[model samples]
Target: MKYDDFMGEVQHRLELPDTGRAVRATRAVLQSLGERLQAGEAEDLAASLPMEVDYYLESADSGQRFDYDEFVGKVADRANVDRSDAAYYAKAVFGLVSELVSAGEIEQVRAQLPDDYEDLFALIDAEEVEE
Candidate 1:
């Protein structure tokens, strides 16, 4: 997706008031996800995202170990939202990302994450995941 399209969709999905908030939320989720994934895996996922957001993922330190609770903590801190809102926003972002990337890529991501992260994809009705 193009940068505008990606930001607009993220703003709409998260019901954020403005572009800046959407940017923060998107970065929070992608950066936290990047920290969880290994370098190559994070790169593979970032390859399909818009350049603006891809940097958030690709730039993370990578391979930082943390559970879902800590993941929520990280996102909450980065986005300046409560833990519940962090999970909600993160889920919406992941849903959108799923639409943009291939199913194999999504599967690879899911495979790397433990079952604790499954709920984060609950919003993903990825009809477009084939590509």
Candidate 2:
């Protein structure tokens, strides 16, 4: 399939209830991740964040609401670790996710590996892991 076709498939998939929730969750994680980066923690993860901050605005724009802990719990399961470990990772992943999802800097880091690319999922989930 062409790139547009592939993108369309992805867009279509995003419409599912589960998939939509996941997107919102991912967005939430990314939002927090961006915040951390703004606070100078992106370097801790070895992430060379974009100079522009527009990419991370989605977290604010997205109206979807997630229980912070519950969002982290989901990412924890995806990472195959306990919530504590997940939260640790979440902080890092969410920070990057927040940046990449943004309009300005995402293309540069878009090709990053899923596991390491956005593993901050671990840390974001740490503070408020759901029951």
Candidate 3:
């Protein structure tokens, strides 16, 4: 999706007040996801995203191992939001990503992350069940 459309969807889905918050939350989730994936996997994922969003993946530090809590903490730190809010933002962004990206790619991401990360993708699972 185009950056504007992507952010608009994010803002709407999360019911955020403005684009700035959506952009921040998107960056937070993308950057955290980039850190979680291998460098090659991150690059592959970036290839499918908008340039603005892709920048976060490209700029991230890959090969860093972290669990779900740390993932949320990193998003919170980067987004400059509270930890609880970060979780909500991450889930919103990730849910959007799961819809936009290829299922195989999403599966690849799931493979790299720990089991706890599954909770963040719960929306994706719910969507599948509905389908």
Model 1, 1-131: lDDT tens digits are 89889999999998999999999999999999999999999999999999988999999999998988899899999999999999998899989998899889999999899999888777664443643
Q: What is the C-alpha lDDT of each candidate?
A: 0.91, 0.40, 0.89
Question: How does candidate 2 score on lDDT?
Answer: 0.40
User: For residues 1-131, could you state the per-residue lDDT of candidate 2 as single tens digits?
Assistant: 33234223333433324444434433344454433332232332223333222244322333333344654665566545577755654554444344334433443232332334344344333433653
> lDDT score, residue 47, model 3?
82
Question: How many collisions per candidate?
Answer: 0, 25, 0
TM-score of every model versus the real structure: 0.93, 0.29, 0.95
Candidate 2: stretches off by over 4 Å: 1-64, 98-131
Query: How far off is residue 130 in model 1, in Å?
Result: 16
| lDDT score for candidate 1 against the true structure | 0.91
Among residues 3 or more apart in sequence or in different chains, the pairs in candidate 3 whose N, CA or C atoms overlap within 3 Å are none
Write the number of the candidate with greater TM-score, choosing between 2 and 3.
3
Which ranges of candidate 1 are over 4 A from the true structure?
125-131
Residue 102, candidate 2: Cα error in Å is: 6.2
Candidate 3 lDDT (Cα, 0 to 1): 0.89
